[model samples]
Target: MRRLTKIAAVTAVMALAVTGCAKKDTQTSSASGSSDKGGLCASGGSGPKIGLAYDIGGRGDKSFNDLAAAGTKKASEDLDATCKESEAAPDEPDSAKEERLRTLADAGYDPIIAVGFVYTPMVTTVAKEYPKLKFAIVDGAAEGDNVTNLAFSPEQGSFLVGVAAGLKTKTNKVGFVGGVKGPIIDPFAAGYQAGVKAVNPKATVEMKWLSDQADQKAFANPPGGKTAATALYDNGADIVFHASGLSGNGVFEAAAAEDKLAIGVDSDQYLTAPKDQQSHILTSALKRVDVAVYDFAKAFKDGTTKAGFDVYDLKRDGVGYATSGGQIDDIKDQIDSYKEKIVSGEIKVPNTL
Candidate 1:
């Protein structure tokens, strides 16, 4: 794969400074509690109050929650909404989660977004308490008249990544590392397996599910991911696709150290990984949580947003790959070709194990 030229050191610093300034501005605006802006969500006299609750991993993982935060920040900036967020500490109690929801509802937030599947039950229960308030949950479904569930077809994006891995692997051997063995990550593994089989009928894919859900420590343990990746590579699997959240960081590290390639999930992790490790990152399978949040916020602002399930797939450009860092250029043409096949019904990506 062709590596994009690195920005000059001074330019990189300047860029970081500018980003820091912008984040500071966003934090200041959010902190000020003003509601006059009209970008994504509307406020009633005090601006729209948008509340977000994160899963156990919290923010700064450079993955799912961070992507969702980008959307919330955009909504805050465009809609002049006051955004409030809370992180569920690792292993938070059910009562605490409920209390957090009630606190946000009591504070008058119109649409409270629960960031992951873990928040489904809490969101469903809270929506019943605040019947007039709207709620959005990503990666999970919540049952209520006021709740809107947003889910991404990662199976679709993963299928494309599977195609890339299938064509690019010289060894004809690939691997998958999942955070947990559950409904959320299973589609990624299943679709990847299908994609690999599509291109290379005889290619063997080594599958590893990091979490059995028997031990609660699976998804957050990077050392475990590193050990798993090392084992996969030792078994002759050269390219690995990981949906392990923070644990996926260890997969990248192992790949970089071993001089192999790895695929990322949720965000454009090529930018998040160390520079020396950039070459090992082939591409990322992106689920547009940011776009979903932004669109729904816009709907709420316009009074046209509906309640119920909203599913985003490749056909809608809601789930796809990232082009940033120019990391995907080497295979760009191939990626486009596969995308067309998928969109035209020539290809079907499986959604289950």
Candidate 2:
């Protein structure tokens, strides 16, 4: 529950970074595991000091950022290390992101992790400047001598939930609401469509996007998500799946209003959603951000961390569907069978529509 501090300093550094002359800050937060004194994060310890910079919507999204935080927190606790965290400012320039990275690096936090794809460019530029600091970028890849790219097969997990939607739907029609239309988000829609067809070829799948490419607000616009999902439900869709980050919160609300089902993405929404809306969340497509982040931090501490691309896919249990509410109990066997096929390469989940 630690919050980002020194906003004025961060804003100043961001401005300076844009001009290529940002001065480093010497201040540090308290250590992660320690409750009192020394700071939120201190430098030069036998254990690692990890820095986690979250994507837009940050920790309270109940989705992606929360998962990232959970993983980093677990790793820090396990190693008895300090973990300083930062969140993205809405529509901030790429330079601001660089400043955040610089702030973490300057404080001697090694194995820094950028928690979203939006950080690819910033990470690319900053990782070069901090060549000695170990870095990891989730959901995107950036090359550097000390960088590790953590990626997941979103399509693989989306397909499993899609199967649940397909089998559970009384109406043959379903819908998908995406945060933005792009390669990053397309896989979710694609896999959901593929799974629907696989389960029932005649089932109709409707796809919609909350915002077009370049509109960063898409991921945070819950109202837009609600409106879109509501429209789909009103149009006769009994089930809806979303890959809309925090925006997906609105989708859950829409489902409750329409008395329909929703499939969550990135985390187990059935468990995270409000108690009233929890039942509407049939399942969730899990990307296991926590697991990846924890592994990266632990590996770095063990001195076995390596730089380069690391892909997490179905075979590695990096992505899957949650069955928290037991709403999908009847179809669990079917979904499990398909999961085996996916892992064994018997089924090739489509990454694109």
Candidate 3:
């Protein structure tokens, strides 16, 4: 729950200024001023206008973006607020991101939320331009007094799920599929590797990345994910855990086809993937992005929005592993024991490999 005083360098991408207008207009909607959408206030009542700029694959990702949408959905219903959303392109430029933020700010939307780390530079530049508007960035840090950085300890959650994979792997061979190789995903690899080593020191963890960088369409590329996961499975990896965004769908598909186990990330993917694939999902590393987004939106509406750095970690219950399939039920007690140790400061999950 402690706020990060400084953001560790996750990547070396330079910040670029958007000199002209951003191309393309995203879809927008007014969630309030309609039928009683079930809120503290009646319908047709106006409230804060919220805007969300999502990363690649947006809502249907059934992963990170969808989880973020769950938060906005809750806000629109509970706070009776109007909401609008935008999606990022596969090879979106820095200016395009900046333009998206600027468009929302200029349209009088307060407390705009940028859903991924790629928006850090854009958030920094745009927050300065719209001094009065509040902005929040997930998975990365942004400067200025008007910006709130909503980050989570993803490694911590992935570590717990790694414990699950280690416990359940009959073949003693598992795999990790990363969306893109960088500091952003290093924690997942590091924590998962450590967790597997912790439980089964001899277990082999095959690591493969879909893309070398963020703009290579790795997170949104399902075919690439399937290929990577299939290779791992065919090579005798019985359980594969993925930190890719929409690309994880391919991992799940591969798992289902091969009758292998797969661990999900960001959301309870067992509930999001196709029904046939649900049985193959052993667990999911929960990032609770919905909670962060919802909490920030509520705080902004209540006039309690704090602009600065904030982090949600294990101690705050912001990250953990999900057992939606009950596949880990036999080891539930053991997993909780590890969770307790993490929360009690007995275990330090590494953030890099």
Tell me each candidate's TM-score: 0.86, 0.87, 0.88
337, model 3: CA deviation in Å? 0.4
lDDT of 1 at 152: 75
Answer with 2 or 3, whichever has the higher lDDT. 3
Prediction 2 TM-score vs. true: 0.87
Better structure of 1 and 3 per TM-score: 3
* Clash count (model 1, backbone only): 7
Report lDDT per candidate: 0.73, 0.77, 0.78
Query: In what order do the candidates fall by lDDT, top score first?
Result: 3, 2, 1
Name the Cα RMSD for model 1.
Answer: 9.1
The backbone clash count of each candidate, in order, is 7, 8, 1
Report the C-alpha displacement of residue 284, candidate 3, in angstroms.
0.5
The local lDDT score (0 to 100) that residue 275 gets in candidate 3 is 89
Q: State the local distance difference test value for candidate 2.
A: 0.77
lDDT winner, 1 or 3: 3
Q: Candidate 3: which stretches are off by over 4 Å?
A: 1-45
